[model samples]
Target: MNKLSGHHHISMLTKNGKRNNDFYTKILGLRRVKKTVNQDSPSMYHLFYGDLTGAAGTELTFFEMPVAGRTVRGTNAITRIGLLVPSYASLQYWKERFQQEEVKHSDITTYAGRDALFFEDHEGLRMVLLNHHGHEVPAHWQSWDGNEIPEEHRILGMGTVEITVRYLQRTVNLLKNLFGYTVVTESEKEAVLQSIAGEVFGEIVVKELEGPSEKPGRGSIHHLALRVASVEDLQEWDAKIKEQGFDSTGVVDRYYFQSLYFRDRNGILFEMATDGPGFTVDSAVEDLGKKLDLPPFLEEKRAEIEAILEPLE
Candidate 1:
């Protein structure tokens, strides 16, 4: 059985940190659960948006990397992020809102027997609001602007994501053999794999691509992470990845959660992360995302780090 609960979070690149915050918190009505900096490059911000409590599977994170430029579409990168909604009425509500906000979006379309509203963020990050047909419905968060978005229509959490791979079978094997994902649905061009146990947040639609490899930049996915039970589980998975001849990052402390990163056959980055000592580790839930927080190792440079980061509205 898969030891993972479901999707822990999906991290993507964005050009402007402030705009990214507004798009998610204001427009999408998610809560800004954590405001921190990229561990690898402390100057750039690493922001997280999720439910009121920053629950697993609901978290969507971003790294502000404007210098990376816009993403180049091709094989081996995550394409669309799907957030779950309650019903068809929610889909209808989004269509009208998209039109009013002048956000580019597609009319509701059917996929896997659910209604999906496809759209893009200001930075051209593809996204979807799909009905939670077979997934657990997480609690909706109160928007910072107070009741701007109705509770019913608010997004539940991260639902599904579309990934483009060069060869379908190789990627499929890795998910099935390693992650215990089973083929829930398949078509000529794409296939949907779900965790054998998790009904929500584990949906991964693999689409075959015929083109030059994707060039990473702004709006490109940094990595997609799956939730593990504990640190021991992470170590076990790390060993499994190495046994499969795929290079793994072993284990790294992410402060909130320990992580292990590895790339697939197509070089798309994947991470297995534990869910504990979370955002509340450094700050209280009420004060989350209100101020900048840093890991203990970086505490000495807090003053220097604060100087470089632009103020968020």
Candidate 2:
């Protein structure tokens, strides 16, 4: 049986790479693990932020689009991203911190049966910080050397990602019948599905709404990448997707990890990515995100790429 783990990395679009870097690293207290360009679009910046070494599930990435417009909210989308925090107290700390930073946010509240605090980035990317409730996600707290965030109160990693579609049952059916996930909670309009890998980090919430597809722009989530065990696992899934007659981007080498992309019946794009040959492949753990790095395929165009891109720092 193939093992599809939790999150690999959730990719979104950002208009200003510099401000996005400042918010995620300094404000949210995540480390910039990689600074590279999008492989498909070499001139655009691809920035990654995560815990210490940029673990697979911990990575939150952005592709910079300099002239992108605002996202028009609607259904048939990956609506909200969830970040895991250590405790209830950590939520309070972040609540105060966000207020001080003038970030848009909401009061502490309950979401999907966990204490969660909803917030948004400058460009209106929706997010929530959920209390992990002693979940054993490998978030390295002592990794920050000069950072001022308290050791005990730091964001762990991503939690449940919410997907809103017109037909929740079709999406739920795809996750269950195709991906082998179990429903944790279910209702007429919303349902939370838990991955077989088993953790809040690997789960997804599906909501049904009668509306049009989301008009995506800056601050819009491009896709959600689920974690798979290895390159071999991805190949098996690639074959399975073909066997099922679903449209897919067959197994592709991403340099860091191998992956395959396919849209579910609901039209939400999901990538199954491997967990190894991580960000540390190009740079040392301590030196990660300190400088621009590119894969071998894109190495020859570094000078040209750098010339066209705006400085992130």
Candidate 3:
């Protein structure tokens, strides 16, 4: 059976689109690669942030919902999102930069034998930056104002995503048996799963939660997306999910890619998406995210969408 290579992108909920865009672009120094609306709700913007080209593993996207209430943390929710920096010096640089910018962050600390800095976004979304040891990913974007961050200290891509669950075995089994992940490390409170070949993107950390189930709202993860090699692999996984007695979206084309959505044992949403027809499909590399680009099906309703969405900065 074909298995997921790694994470494609992580989609989270945010209260405002412009604030979300500024935080990722100006504050974090990431590139805003796509400006589109949520597929289900054409009124709300779905903003995508990533490396220079918005590579698969580097993407962090959000669905804007201004009126959504704050999320209540509990069991079975993604607790933190990790971004990879190049070195220990990079971590120190970030610490100093956060202090200078007044971004809420913790002092540098060690986790899993690497230096890290924990911080929260303007909307109180938990995040961490870890040392990635200089893994080369496509390209990275410079600051919009031309005051560029040094290449070495810039974010590499997505790191380990942390999730809280009531029980780990069910989730563990699904990851291993269905998703083709192998447990690389485990402890009483946490277990880390990665691809058998040891690629970085699908590295997931599951922590046992002692509290009640989580409530979804602003600042909660809408879904975690994993990558499949092709559309054929996606179709196979869709059938596999149904055969395993889980309800799945089957196959839905998202213009840039094909996708299938399902909930894991703990009720956290999981998306399996193909890794092709990327963001560049709709917009030029230099001009991506400059204007809203709708899928062909939604093209007819472009005026309606523009009317509904507030201009993102």
Candidate 4:
């Protein structure tokens, strides 16, 4: 009965690395924890943004693929990503800021028993901010001097994410058997699952479609990662995922952590990632996101790789 702690992060495809960096880091006030290239494709950038420490649950990563098409908002894809704010006061601050910035948003809604504010990023990626009542905000994330957003107001982590699927039972089963989640509640249109460790919650909703099924596109979720306790637990789950007949890529080193990825029945990519040796592994706590870092394996190619990446600011 190995269960995931909760979400590690969600990866999204962005149009420009620098622009995405500015929005998440500058406007959204997340810390740019890492600046590196995708291991599979060195020509593209893989940027990570999160709390100051880049802790397990508080991260959102991106694959810079400027030429990709906009994500179509229907059927068999992640619909929205929700981030946890510290309190109701913080939510009010964000509401005012969003209005001041002229960002389109919806009125606060009560979903799954939490107060939530929904909005979109520059690329139209739907996001929600919620007041997470029971969770403690990690000490290292109390203030981010970078975005001038105080630590008291930083994002707690992902609250819940929506996955719209056509085949509901299969997707629900995979989440339970493979990821160690328990069904908390369900409606005719949606099912909500709580993680084993209960650090965060998630939703898998069913959306009926009329014609052909849609493919995962840009601005759509690239993958959702489930946090494992350690590398050993990750390997154990790797075998389990294979036994369940899902083809998973065996452990791949992500510098900050290790990960194994496979697509779910509906083609949404899912990753099981370890929770250790975080961003502080290569850099000091005070120096994270201050400069680009190359993993030992990529160090030799740094000069060439840096040349291909468009400068951020």
Candidate 5:
């Protein structure tokens, strides 16, 4: 009965690596923590963006699939992503910045009794800026003076993940029974779940929608990963998943962190990953995201991989 922590990271799809790189690192102000290839598919790029060191719960990642078409939005998908800012005033700062940069965004409004502003990335990726005003959650933000925005108003970390499912209760049950989340709020159409850690990052919004399954492509979220304390916790969770009649990828040695993956009843991919041996394993902290990084298993094929992939910079 190992309880899962909050969000580790949310991985999405992007069509243009260079544009994705610019939008996140340059426009959004999140540091490009890692530049690497997708382990399962070396032909594609896997880019990670986060706070100074790409802490566990702060990552917002992308997999570049140049040929990927537009995402066909529908049910049973991770719909909207929420990014946390230091305070309610940060929303105003971002709103003004978005206007200046011509970033598509909505007027500041309240969602679930919190001040929030909605915006879209270059690829129509839906995002919301939520206030972390009174959450007691310390944001893992360290600033470099060169960013377009100031240090106090920097985008902190991932706040919440919203998932839309055809069968709501099944997904809700998985969150409660398997993941050990407590439902904090609920209505006819949605429910908000909080993890044991009880912070802004631990919140999840589950919405019930009746529609066709999502046809994923560019801007579509691929999976949502939750944090596990250690490899021992992951192994225990792996057994629990199988015992309950769910198929899992077991323990995978992702060079940075070990991961176990399984889909929910709604087909939303959920991953349990450990926090150790992070982005600095192969590259120095200062040199991270500066060059192409490959794990030892893929080192031999680096030349072949590099030749096929265009320069992401």
Candidate 6:
């Protein structure tokens, strides 16, 4: 069975780019590695934030669409994204930081057998911090305080993604048959699936929605990307996705990575993204988030794009 390794990154729509930037960079301390515009909507900005190199598994991206409606939360969409932190101590530190910064947060809770801290970003997108297991700590995860967090205590990777769906069978079948996910557990309202070996990454939780359809809007997840090792892997998956009667766009070059977008049987947008030419392609590891980068394709139009984008600082 070919299974995805874990989550790559989750993309969301936000109304305020500056506020999002300040929150993720200044407060959360995630590095802002890329400052570009959305290919579908060049007039708006697209931002990427993550660990030092903005590696595949440690990224959170955003599409700045101020006019997009507020996303309705229900079934058939991504509910929240989880980020694996270093340790229980990091969690405690964050709890204090959130309070000191006047950021609203929830008390600790146990989910998926791990302790977690739940919070929202400036734009109201939901997020979770967990003590991840079974992966190497990222080399470039900068600590908030001058104190050092041992390598053994750094984040492992994204642990899981929550998906809401109206009907379980179609989504479940898609996961089992097409995506190579095996049902790990099941209940009346939800089922958990683990990806087949050698796929992208992350566990997927499919939850049954009990209400009406939802409308995608701000503070809502736009799509969740599944990691593909390279362009060839993505092409293979693209063919596989299309063969299953689902339409998939050709590989699109995202400055730091290449990706193909498609939706699952349940209508949640998914991206198979590559891990090459990472965040360091444009900036040094120590100086990521210091500048705005334009992909080669968009270089000629840089002046125009720059004119339209709001300044991050």
| Best model per lDDT | 2
lDDT of 2 by residue, 75-138 (tens): 8999999998989999999999999999999999999889999999999999999999766774
Candidate 3 least-lDDT 10 residues: 138-147
lDDT tens digits, residue span 1-313, model 5: 5577678999999999999999998889988889999999999999999877788888999999989999999999999989888788899999999999899999999765578999999998999999888455544445445467787788878888899999999899999887789998888889999886466687899999997999999989999999887999899999999998999999999999999999999999998899878998998878878899999999999999999988966
Query: What lDDT score goes with residue 257 in model 3?
Result: 88
The C-alpha lDDT values of all candidates are 0.84, 0.88, 0.84, 0.77, 0.88, 0.75
Cα lDDT over the full model 4: 0.77
Q: Which ten residues in a row have the lowest lDDT in candidate 1?
A: 138-147
Q: Could you give candidate 6's per-residue lDDT for residues 1-313 as a string of tens digits? A: 2345556788889888999888887677676777778877788988988766677777888999878777777778888787777678777877887898888788878665578888887667887877653444434344323123344444444666888888877777887888778788788878888774322136777889878767788888989888777788788888888999998998988868899998877888988888787877877777666676777777898889888888989
lDDT of 3 by residue, 262-281 (tens): 99888888998887888899
Task: Name the regions of candidate 2 deviating beyond 4 angstroms.
Answer: 138-146
Q: Candidate 3 at residue 128, lDDT?
A: 93
Q: Identify the runs in model 4 with alpha carbons over 4 angstroms from their true place.
A: 137-143, 197-212
So what's the TM-score on candidate 1? 0.95
Worst 10-residue lDDT window for candidate 5 reads: 137-146
Runs with alpha carbons beyond 4 Å of true place in candidate 5: 138-146
lDDT of each residue in 1-313, candidate 4, tens digit only: 3567677788999988888888888778898888888888888988888876877778899999878787766667777898888888777888887898777777877655679889988888888988886476444344456776656666766778877777776677788766667787766666777774344543433333333455545666788887787888888888988998989899999878999999888877888888778888899978887787878899999999989989997
Q: How accurate is candidate 2 locally (lDDT)?
A: 0.88
Candidate 6 whole-model C-alpha lDDT, 0 to 1: 0.75
